[model samples]
Target: MEPLPAAVTAILLDIEGTTTPITFVKDILFPYIQDNVEEYLQKHWHEEECQDDVRQLKLQAEKDSGQKGFVPIPSNTEAELQVIKGVAANVLWQMSLDRKTTALKQLQGHMWRSAYASGKVKGEVYDDVVPALKKWKGAGMKLYIFSSGSVEAQKLLFGYSIEGDLLELFHGHFDTTVGSKVESDSYRRIADKIGCSTENILFLTDIIKEAEAAREAGVHVAIAVRPGNAALTDEEKSEYHLITSFDQLPLQSTH
Candidate 1:
């Protein structure tokens, strides 16, 4: 492994296919939502928080529909039922397409909280992640997470991980609420939020497009290749540092 770049003082990590197995998300978390969303919504629909979620999803759905008139969600049982079914369908559709809209992510996070608390789901991280995180923290390197998952969901995951609570390792979390990961401006915003120069933050992920976006934002970038991650093209391999394990990442001693 090469020496840690001299300028890097902070590390930004992506969750899926980077620290956690993609299967945990695609097979477990997502399927749990698909199987349980309607029931969960039905059980909680009258509550203020659930109602708020429904309202937000309806607004997003209406915006996406591009229709002229208002799509009213009435208070009556029959009307509420109709609206809830429509919102559930839309949420399922969005999940199927893997859309990263804030409302959807928020609602998914809400649902996942219950699943995680009930011990129905637990987060998975690569074997190398814990040791690497400890080493980096010990060496005075700040660590953060940037993922499409809502900050709440991110907390739920690390807070309930198979490795035991690992949320303490992260300095902060960023989600779609900050900006799209594919946009360079998002990386710039993240750097600002972390109070670091963009060039001083090393961003790691399995996605080439995201790596390119961070690079364009003037941040250091690396591509992580893990089991179950999408195969990288030769072009990507040639353009960025490819890391198969967090252990392979070089860290300079701060002591």
Candidate 2:
């Protein structure tokens, strides 16, 4: 906690559950998709991406459910489509049902973009986020975002943030295209893209696997502890640097 330890150069952050509350995404935003999926599909089915994604989801459902000819079962009946609704209940299912990050992002973008447009939602950032970002930027620390959410969705969240356009605070953004955050290769790709050695970059996230992957890539790691998440045991907690608040960060400046 001593003035960010001096070794850190660039900062990579996760969106949901780190800078933003996990409840915002899991409870509010995710449920919005569940509630609107039928209406959304009915209206958007003719769109090429929607058609492609639905077809892919069907295949995924079949694979997951272990049925032959696993392409999405034709939902000629409302009951059949209703069953599909059950399958979509798990977001992890949704991600696995369609391996295409583009499709996942497109759907998320449609949801959040509409939510933002209709005033149904505005993005939230932790109290520590804005001033800390400004402070870090002022201290010449470069910033980037790495999230499972699409980069377009990432932009919208920050762009329409409650703090009013926090997107300007970041130097770059990356998403599942590089591979999921759980994989060490993702951090390596990010490090290469940013043109820096991994040791100089710091990754902050609420998920331990992500921090572990960053650590594997030689980046310094910090775990953000937001409320209502599963508490880590002492052994689990010992593996990484932990931060309970943005102000807890060892920033050099005394704002």
Candidate 3:
């Protein structure tokens, strides 16, 4: 790979399938929520925070009622078990479809915070990611994260990662709140928010559509070819710069 373009002053990263393995979320995090949602609710059901999560989920459920396979959450007035069951089922249904609703993300973020705090879970990062981030940070590259995961969930992952806290390496975080990753305008908006031209940001992700979107916004794009990431088409492999590890990023200088 050639040296990174001198105009690139910032890095925008995707989490799953980029800096972290896709299986971390697919095999661990989501399943953790699925297996523990009921127990988590039963344990913390009386807490105002938990109740609020349920309230938001209930609202989402109501909104989704007209849609197929929507799980109905019972109001708090119902029997405690039934209410919890309803919320649990609703959450599971949303998860089954991999929904990213703020309601569902809010609940999942809280649950992950607890799981991380108690050492029941630790975030997974590629072995090369931390050192590369340090090098990039030291070289004065402004770094940011853009992921489908809620910002709080993103924080939890890096805050308790295997390599210790990696949050300090980032300049900021963006979630779906900005926009979908596949939208070119989302890249432009992120660049605008970060006070840079879109051309100054290099985005790394495992998905071709996201790369194309970022490229459309005039940002440089590289696809991370990591283990467990979706296989890239041969056409895609020939069309974009690809790296199997962060160290493959061609920095202009160590200074």
Could you say which candidate leads in TM-score?
A: 3
lDDT of 3: 0.92
- Superposed by TM-score, candidate 2 places the C-alpha of residue 214 at a distance from the truth, in angstroms, of 1.3
TM-score of each: 0.87, 0.78, 0.94
As a whole number from 0 to 100, the lDDT of residue 237 in candidate 2 is 90
Ranking of candidates on lDDT, top first: 3, 1, 2
Question: Clash number for model 2?
Answer: 0
Q: After superposition, how far is residue 59 of candidate 3 from its true place, in Å?
A: 1.9
List candidate 1 stretches off by more than 4 Å.
Answer: 64-87
| Pairs in clash, predicted candidate 3 | none
Q: Rank the candidates by TM-score, best first.
A: 3, 1, 2
The regions of model 2 sitting more than 4 angstroms off are 41-105, 252-255
Clashing pairs in 2: none
Which of candidates 1 and 2 is the stronger one according to TM-score? 1
Supply the TM-score for candidate 3: 0.94
> Between 1 and 2, whose lDDT is larger?
1
1-255: candidate 2 lDDT, tens digit per residue: 476656678999998888999888767776677677666666666788667766655555555555332334445455755644543443344543444444455566776787777777788889888998988888888999999888887888888888888877899999998998999989989999999888878899999888888899888898999886658779869877788887678755322
Cα lDDT tens digits for candidate 3, 164-208: 988999999999889999999999999999999998999999999
- Top candidate, metric lDDT: 3
Per candidate, the number of residue pairs that clash is: 0, 0, 0
